[model samples]
Target: MCIVKKFYVADSHFGHERIIEMCARPFSSVDEMDETLIANWNAVVGDDDIVYHLGDFAMNLADEDRVRAIFNWLRGRKFLILGNHDYKRVNQLHPTLARLEWMATPTTSLETTDGGHRVYLSHYAHRTWPGQHKGAFHFYGHSHGNCPPIGRSRDVGVDLPDVAFRPRTFDELTKGMIE
Candidate 1:
């Protein structure tokens, strides 16, 4: 049996000082927020684990170094689902691009078996995603937890309480969504 562990997170918005004030993040400075986010992510994600970052990994398109640094600091094998803010900026640095396993479009279907469950991943939550009615669980990050839950679909954004400002395992997310 192939056993794979999957985790999900989104909208980190690293390096965006305005995000701290905008999101009411509990950090006094951008550096503090960045360190805390990196630490929190590394705490739960292991080296071999897989993480699907839904979108908005960082701000400041000009700061490619900061973006690459943040990517290197994070644990797990990373995959990205491009968000609104990620379009042009993410392509600026090809040097660190190899760190990611793959970069997907805003909406993509991920067919993987983790603990015998099928999962669908996207940047925005969908009311009716492919294979959703057939027991496929959908995970998304956009809307920042403001949107209501849709059937088996749940916002896996780090901004939400269920995720606790960190990447969450598939089992952890599913349990939170069911409750």
Candidate 2:
């Protein structure tokens, strides 16, 4: 039997030129940043993989077409956990919005099994989540590696050093958190 793979990523902030300076991203330009992000995403995520994107996907609300184009370039069956910046922009970008498997608000729970482990998904880190005491792993974004890990919860945002600004497999994410 084949086991499907699941991945997690967050805070890509695609098309946001100011983010390069704000986040101290290595890219010299927004175009370069966007290209690198797309390349990194495609490198780790396969076509069959399911990726949970924990918000702030893009900042360019003015150009819906460009945002849609960027989404088209990515690989995976993506589920969006809406972040602060995703509101008006993502809704306007119909092409990208239509392609998502599902979309939820910043604070939502997703109960799923990965690598024989139960996990929860959300956009913002939580002190206590559903099944926290029961050993259910929690994955979240929005803190962008600034927030400390709480209990079994981890920041799945791409801003972390371990993730290298790309989507990471479920096993990879859990392993990093465990270490």
Candidate 3:
């Protein structure tokens, strides 16, 4: 298994100009979009931090080598939870699996040491899982227009609120969930 860290960011959704324009908001051009993402990323993330790009990394890539190189330039470790837009050709360019760390699959589960559960990193929120309403948080991203549902339950982890989109600090993520 990879060396997991206490904090991570979900869904950078880099390199897709159309989706970035539509979903990220206020990005007049792709360059502006890249700048916004990079700035937000650098602000919250430190060199030792780990980030989880939970899908839709690149739709049309001219080169994967350049992509991995960019990841390196970003200055932190990355773990990708591949989304629908990721193609096999893009996977071939990376050194490891389709995603940087995690396998490129439709749905997977990640467990915190204390046993809280979260699901659906890269895709959109279609409909909330009825049974999961009282169980673990089900995180998805297909419906870019909607926000991930955060239901209340006794069993739910404490940090569930901050787990959604928008920038969050590493300390905020770990403090709420870990101890």
TM per candidate comes to 0.85, 0.86, 0.59
**Lowest lDDT 10-mer window, candidate 3?**
152-161
Best by lDDT: 2
Model 1 misses residue 48 by how many Å?
1.2
Model 1 Cα lDDT, one tens digit per residue, 1-179: 53447788888988889988887888999999999999999998888888888877778756777788888889888887766667654444333333444544333335555566677777778888777777888888778778887888888887898787899888888884554
Which of the two candidates, 1 or 2, achieves a greater lDDT against the reference? 2
Positional deviation of residue 37's Cα in model 3 after best superposition, in angstroms: 0.7
Residue 158, model 3, lDDT = 12
Mark the 10 consecutive residues where model 1 has the least summed lDDT: 92-101
Ranking by lDDT: 2, 1, 3
lDDT of each: 0.76, 0.79, 0.46
Number of the top-ranking candidate, with TM-score as the measure:
2
Which ranking of candidates, highest TM-score first? 2, 1, 3
